[model samples]
Each structure stands twice: as C-alpha cells, then as structure tokens.
Target: MTVRTDLLIVGAGPTGLTLGIDLARRGVDALVVERADGLFPGSRGKGIQPRTMEVFDDLGVLDAIRAAGGSYPVGMIWQDGKRVGEHRMFDPAEVTEDSPHAEPWMVPQWRTQEILFGRLEELGGQVAFGREVVGLTQDEDGVTVRFPAGESVRARYVVAADGGRSAVRRAVGIGMTGETVDPSPMLVADVRIAGLDRDNWHIFPPHGEGDGFLAVCPLAGTEDFQVVARFPEGASVDVSLEGIRKVVAARSHLAPDDVTEVRWASGFRPRAALADRFRDGRVFLAGDAAHVHSPAGGQGLNTSVQDAYNLGWKLGAVLRDGAAAGLLDTYEEERRHVAADMLGLSTSVHRGEVRRGEATCQLGLGYRESSLTKETRATPGAVRAGDRAPDGNLDGVRLFDAFRGPHWTVVAVGVEAPVVPEAVRVVRGRALESYGCGVFLVRPDGYVGWAGDQTAGGLGYLGRFGGR
Candidate 1:
C-alpha cells in the first residue's frame, strides 16, 4: 500500500535531516527517506560555520551541537619528522552579542547527522531507511515516488537531498554545470592513531615534485583523527586501512602501524558543479544534489544545510501557512544565486586564492536582490532587507529569542511598533546599533524580509506570506 506525506525528503544526511526537523517543528507532515540502511558514517564535512550555528540555534540543537563539538585546532606543520611551524586553520573573529559563534566548530559528519536525527525524532519526525527511489512521477497535484520493493509514497512536494550522484536529480532530467576544481584525487579517512596528539591539526607538505600534501585533523569530542592526503594528478587513491597506513608512513614520521584503526574511508576528485535549476515542478533539489562544492573551504555542508533552512520555511508557508503558491518560486530565485556564489568561494579556497575566514564563516550571505526582500527606508541601515538580522537585546527581549520559532518577527528599533498578526512576534527597543532607526520584518529563516524607516509598507510585505 502507498503511504502519503505532505513532503518527502530523499536523504538522511544533514541536508534532509535538517529540513525534516524544521518542517516537523512547524507541524508539517514530512517524511525523510534514505537509500542507505543507516545514517552516513563518515567524518567528512566536519566544520560547522557560524551561520549554520545560528540555524542550529533556532532548530533547538545548538546546545547539543556545541556539546558534541569543539573549536577547530591550530594547524601544526611538520618537516623532517619534527615539528616545524604553526598555521591557523581559520582567521579568527571576535564573538559579540550580534554574532555569537565566531569560528567553525569541529564535529564529525556522522555525529552531526546523529544530533540532527535525534532532534528530528524529538520533534516527532521519522525517517525510512533503505527506501531508495527507483521511480518517480509528478504532475500538477503531487509526486508519486516509487521504491524497489513495490512500495510507494505520494507527497505534495518532493525534495532531492540525496547527494552528488542523486538518482532523483537524474530522473528529473536536471543538468549539473561545473568544472573539476582539482585533477588530483584525494583520500579521506577517519581513523584512530596511536602516536598523534589531538591538540593540533597535523599538516605535512609535499616533500617532492610529484608528492602531495597530507593533513590529519583531530575530530573534536572524539578520538578519531581525520586523515586527508592528496595524490598526484591521474593517480588512483587507495582507501583501505593498509593503503592509508602506507600513505601515512610515506608522508609523515608515523609508522605503518601508527594508524590503529580505520573507521571510515573514501576518495574523491574535487569538482564544483551547480544544478541547472533547483526545481522542476513540485520537486526541489537541495544539498549536494543541487550544487556540488569542493571541501576546501568547508562550504559544501554549510551551504547545503542553509538550503534546507531556506526552503523549509517557504514550503511551510505554502503548505501550512496558506501563503501564495508563487512564493515557492523564490526558493530557486534566492538560493540558486547564493549557491553559485558559494561554489565560487569554495573553488577559490581550493585554489588558495581565499582564506578560511569571514567568507568561509558564511555569516555575510544574504538575499539583497531577492524579490521577497523589501527595503523601503530612504536610507537603509547597516542591516537592510535581505540581510541577516543581528542578535541583540531590545527592551529586555533578546532578538534571537524572539526569532527562534517558525514564525515571522518584527524588530522595531527606536520606532513605534506596527500592528501585526498574532503569528508574528514583535520586539521593540530604544536603539540596536546593528539595526538603525527602522522597522525590520525578520523571516522565519532569520533574514530581514522587510525594512522600512516607517511602518507604511511593512504590513503589505507581511501579507504576501500569509502573515495577515
């Protein structure tokens, strides 16, 4: 018998799980399905940027995420089997009331997924593992997704978060346009090392012309050290324990037996690609399915998570909030451009043209050009419509506290608050430096949707999203 869900998410990774949690809290009837028998077991995409930290905060998993991870360690470079120099993994940023998380946090991807899954469960959400989509058919009403065992699911909307080799993306005939960021194949593995200190991310530069760099980073909150080694162009990477041992021995002072255990291992050639379109009818592409990025800048996962954050609210608006169906179109219009920009940033980091600092943190990403954004101020403040709303205190109310739920928020600073629907939360105060004299309508995703010197057009902007 076929089951029915309002939304079907095709992946159990961070992207799909994040979307599931967001929708679940919003009381949306959503199901997440994974082709694998269990969650992805790897330490890939371990860095959680500052922007994602805010998203996690709103999702009610920030404290758990913070407990499960630690700040990134400084890089320790070695040469001639001895300590050589030091390098900072990320340029530092000061933590302030507005931006709390200043740097990236290190949490193995597996642990991160587990935390997200647990939160989803707490919100009364469920995921069906081994439910691979073998076939898909969609019309104006909804999409019917088929599985190999003759089971099927009918969803009003389908989200493809199934990773780079997305079968759903293929079935939908979406093309990915991209280039190989690097010709050299790299091997990444999570292993227990007997002779390594967990204090620093060990780096060993290539000693010869044909050799490549090797980095072993300690996965915070765990004993596993992620081993990443680059190989020459056109060389095959071995992902087995023996292969990893060989690479470790040949590149560093560590002996072959130093790598005690290989928990997970994988190999890939870095490439940057973007889906020609993020949506086709009722199905949407997200995460690796939408845009594949090099892991250099730690952007792939963060960008993917934000994609869900961006799409989740819009889906809730259309499916539950009685908003206009046309609002869904802004998902592609807003996210595709952000994805494109992030793709370029990751590629640049891979090429060493950029550093893992502010750009990598992702706090600066916004939708200034989005059609959904309305800036009616004669002179916009530092924070404008389409910019992220900064966290601060306004008349004894914390801004983030007000913006936490799956609802719109109005930050009226040094201005009289306007009448708004009960669905919208309002915070009024004397003066928030981040936000000058203006009324700001913050979206569910924490970005300012409308900012005005006066409350003239703010209500009309809110009406578009069923806030009236």
Candidate 2:
C-alpha cells in the first residue's frame, strides 16, 4: 500500500512532532512516522532552555510543559561522604518583561516527547509507528519513499528527523564532517535511589588514580534521580542496574542498596557533527539527522526543536500560500549556519572551554545574517532586522499575545508604519526598550524579518515573502 501526503516527516522525535503541530495548525497536511513502536524511553535530554519555553508558549504547549517540569536544582559537591558546598549550575538570571523565561527547566526527554506527541494529536496530526524509511527517491515534482515491508509513500517534500544515524540521510548521500569531543565513555540512567536529598545535584569530582567524575541529579517532577558517570579512556560502560548501583556506591558515600530501582540506562561517547547540506531536491534533514551535538550544555534537543520551528512556516508558505519556491531555499541558508555555530558551542561546553551561561539559554541567538532579513534604516536601534522579537506591552496589548499564531505582524514602534496586507496583523504602539523606534515586520517564528525607520522599501520587503 502507498500513502500520500503533502509533507512526510520521518522520525517522530521532538523535531518531527513540533513541525507536525506547526504544519497542522497552518492547515498543511503533514505525516510523522517513527520506526520504534513508541516514543524514546530515556532521560538523556533533560534540560529545556528558556528560549524553547518561549517557543512552547507560541505552540500552545507552555501550560502543559510548565505543569510537567520544574526549575533545575543547584549543584552540591561531595567529599569523603560530607557535603562540601553548593554549586550553582546555571548563571543567575532575573525574569523580566523582555525575557519572561530566564532559566532552564528540568523535564526528561521522554516526558517532553509525550507532551509534544499529545499536542500533535490535538492539532489533528498523525504519527504512524512501526514505519521505517528504508529507501528514498526524489525528483522535480516529489519524492517516493519505500519501507522495509515494501509499503511506500509519496510526499511533496520529505524531512529526515531520524536521529544521528539517519537512514534517509545516508540514502540521499549527504556527508557529515565531525570529530569526537571526549575520549572517555559516559553512562546515564534514570533510577530510584535512597539516602540522597533531592534538593541539589550531587557531584563527586574525579578521584584521580583512574576513577572518573560522577554526578547524581534529581529529576524534577518525578521520583527518579538521573545518574551520570564517566569511565577511563578505552573502557566499556556497563548499563545494567547492578552496574549502576555499584558505580554509585563506589563514587559517592551511598551503598549499593541505596539504589532501590532502575528504570532505564544507556551509554555513549560525546561527539559533534554537522551535515554538509540541510536540503537535497525535495528532501530536507532536521534534528540529529542534520547536526549531531554532544549531550552537554543542554543544546541538542532545544536546537532541534527550533530547527522545526524555523522550517515549518516556510514549508507552509511555499506549499499552501502560493509563495515563490525560492523561499524554501532560505531554510538551509539560515538554519545551517545556526546549526554549525551551535555544534561549536556544544563542543566547547563538553570540553570545559566555555560555561553553560547565557549562550546555552539560546536567547541571544538570531538570524542577523540571513538573506531574508532587511535592515534599511541607516542607524538601526537596539533591536534590528533578524533579531528575536522581545516580549513586552505595546498599545495596551501584550506583544507575544499579538504575535501568537500563523500570521505576520507589522508593528509600528514610535513611528508611522506602512500598511501591510489585510492578511497580516497590525499593532500600533509607542516603542519600549523591548523594541526600538522603527517599523518591525515580525515573522511567524517570532523574529523581526524587516526593520526600517519609514515606509520606504516596506512593501518591497514584504513582497519577497508573499506579503503584499
């Protein structure tokens, strides 16, 4: 049997599900497929950055995400069975009107996926489990994908979100150039343990003499503690329950019996890589499929989610709104650069060359160099073209509330703005520090696409995106 859809998404992880929800809400027909029978059952990506929380607000899942997670706990260093001192994990950040979410939230990757999956279903999207894309072929018109069972699918566009070892990426002959970030192997698991307080992330520094660093962090909103341990170079990491208990007993003050239950466990060597290209013909690569990051600084999953957010609206515009197909080319141009930079940041964090501070939170990241951005003003203010639209009150209306949905926003900030197409929303208000004095054209993904001091070249800018 052959199924057909306007967009086919392979690998229903956070990236695919996020794109699915965005497309579904835009009235774009998209299907997400997974090879596994269910969502991934691990607590690998447990840290959700503040920028992603803002994205969740726009996607209509902020309430559920906030309910399912809590703020990260402070780190507690241990020495010889005694608590030495408390170590702050992230830099102190105060929540303000411009930046609402200031800290990273703690939610296991499994739970995050479940929440996104539920949202996808609520948006009238579908995910077909037990389906794997074994083969693929794309032409000028569309792409045809074949499964192991001989069933096939035809889609106007195919996106590969199938993780680090992506079959679709391999089939399409894209190359990933990268290097291993760490020489040692690491074990991560979610287990129920006793004799450890849940107030802080317990840390046991390396004992030198061949022993590696160990840390046990309490998974907020759940009863499990995520255990992390490093092994010497060229050593194998045991993931069994007994092995995890032994490691905890050997590294910390607790005994083996302290680990009462073990839910899941896995091990991996940290590595970072980026694909040569994000798109090929009618196919595109997303998430780990396009760029692989070290599980440090909590960037992989958050970056992946943003990738889908960036591409979803462009796909919707080209496929449903009769926009020029050239708009699709910007996806690779904008996202590939961000992915490359993020890969470098992840590598730095893994090697201890940088701290997980403002950069890891991802609030400062933007598409200032994107070709889609137009800054016609000679002296742009604090906020310029391609900057993330800050949240604030304008004209007695909340900015985020006005920008929430599948519509472009033409904001007049302390200036007379040009009139945009009726399909776009117009908000007139005095300029706050969140946005500077000018006319700002906000994209669906919450970035200022174009900024200017007057109406000059306003319509010309909008015309490129099917706006006027």
Tens digits of per-residue lDDT, candidate 2, 134-221, equal: 8999889899999899999999999999999999999999999999999999999999999999999999997778999999999988
- How does each model score on lDDT? 0.95, 0.91
lDDT of model 1 at residue 230? 96
Clashes per candidate (backbone, < 3 Å): 0, 0
> Where is model 1 more than 4 Å wrong at Cα?
none
The most accurate candidate by lDDT is 1
Residue 306 of model 2 has an lDDT of 95
- Poorest 10 consecutive residues of model 1 by lDDT? 459-468
